[model samples]
Target: MLARQLEQFSCIRQARVQLAPQSWQSGAVIVLEPARPEAMPDAAALDRMLDTLALIPDAPDKRHVLVFDTEGRRLYPDHETDETARREQEVALERQALRVLRPLLDGNGRAEVLVSLDEAEKGRTTGRRTISVLLEENAVPETVRPHLESLLGQACALEEGRGDALRICFLPARRNAAALRGLALTFAVLALAGMAAFF
Candidate 1:
């Protein structure tokens, strides 16, 4: 069944279908990764793929499905009122934002960011052309900070958007795994001391 479904899209060189035992929302999960990084599925091909996913069994739950790209972008079940799509879009945006921001981090830096689209009105057309990156406390270097914003702008310009949108962000930079080990050791020592005092 999967092989037949895959043959329809030449752009989709490979496909995988997994019937997960538990889902936050119950349905089949279809993952598609392109043969090339730059390959994108057109609207009609995407629609057909969604239709193919619809045929999968939803015996124990409602017939809802999710399709994700290699970069973690959600591609299916994008209904008008689906609240889940908003969360998925945020995830996709974050992945894209990180692609631009990670290079600025000079190895020691780590960050968690929230990427959002704020609508701006210029004239008759409505736009969410501005990409806003909210850097939740991070270890970004002071020297790299100056040039990071311009690089983001250039990165967005090279990609596609709803309109002539551009990217701009202030990404800041971690918790080392070694720090967690130290925390565990401290807890153990405290527990032993308390037990000794109690006895």
Candidate 2:
């Protein structure tokens, strides 16, 4: 819906919108590829685009929009260099976590995880490292949890945020292996019961 609205403008060739990091609650980032590289949207056009983004339910109440050209240039919040850097750093952390978690999840791209770095520990060992992994029913398989946590802890220990505690959380996303196995067992039992009754 938002993309269609943005496409109505002449300057926008295509508009791709994504929540900051990975989920909807996070702020929005709109990457715009212009119809003509030399003819970027004017300030008024940008304002209109931002307004449309702000109207989305997931958008924050403060309504700050970050626009980036295909070249990784910041188009708005021009003064918020620190904020931009912070978001980039968060994204970097997220990518690192995914590097380790993806294989464990069978390369499921739909898996959601957020890795947040504490700014105070930017270059120091005293900063906190938080890894939030979205799992089904707040459960992590006994076999997977310890190994996954160990891997993440090792990653944090090696990074700048190693001095403080390493926090790991399991948020709700898709069902994990244990849950799927239980579901399969239930189906098997029901099927056996039906066959017994028929025989």
Candidate topping lDDT? 2
Q: Summing lDDT over every window of 10 consecutive residues in candidate 1, give the lowest-scoring window.
A: 18-27
Model 2 TM-score (2 dp) = 0.53
Ten contiguous residues minimizing lDDT sum, candidate 2: 156-165
Candidate 2 lDDT by residue in tens digits, 1-199: 6666677778889987656644224566667889998767855658766776566665643244567787767675565665566665555566677677666663343455565555554465333556666654334455787687678766545454254444555555566689999999999999999999999
lDDT for predicted candidate 1 compared with the true structure: 0.56
The best candidate in terms of TM-score: 2
Residue 88 in model 2: shift from native, Å? 1.2
lDDT of each: 0.56, 0.63
Residue 61 displacement (Å), model 1 = 16
Q: How many clashes (backbone atoms < 3 Å, residues ≥3 apart in a chain or on different chains) does model 2 have?
A: 0
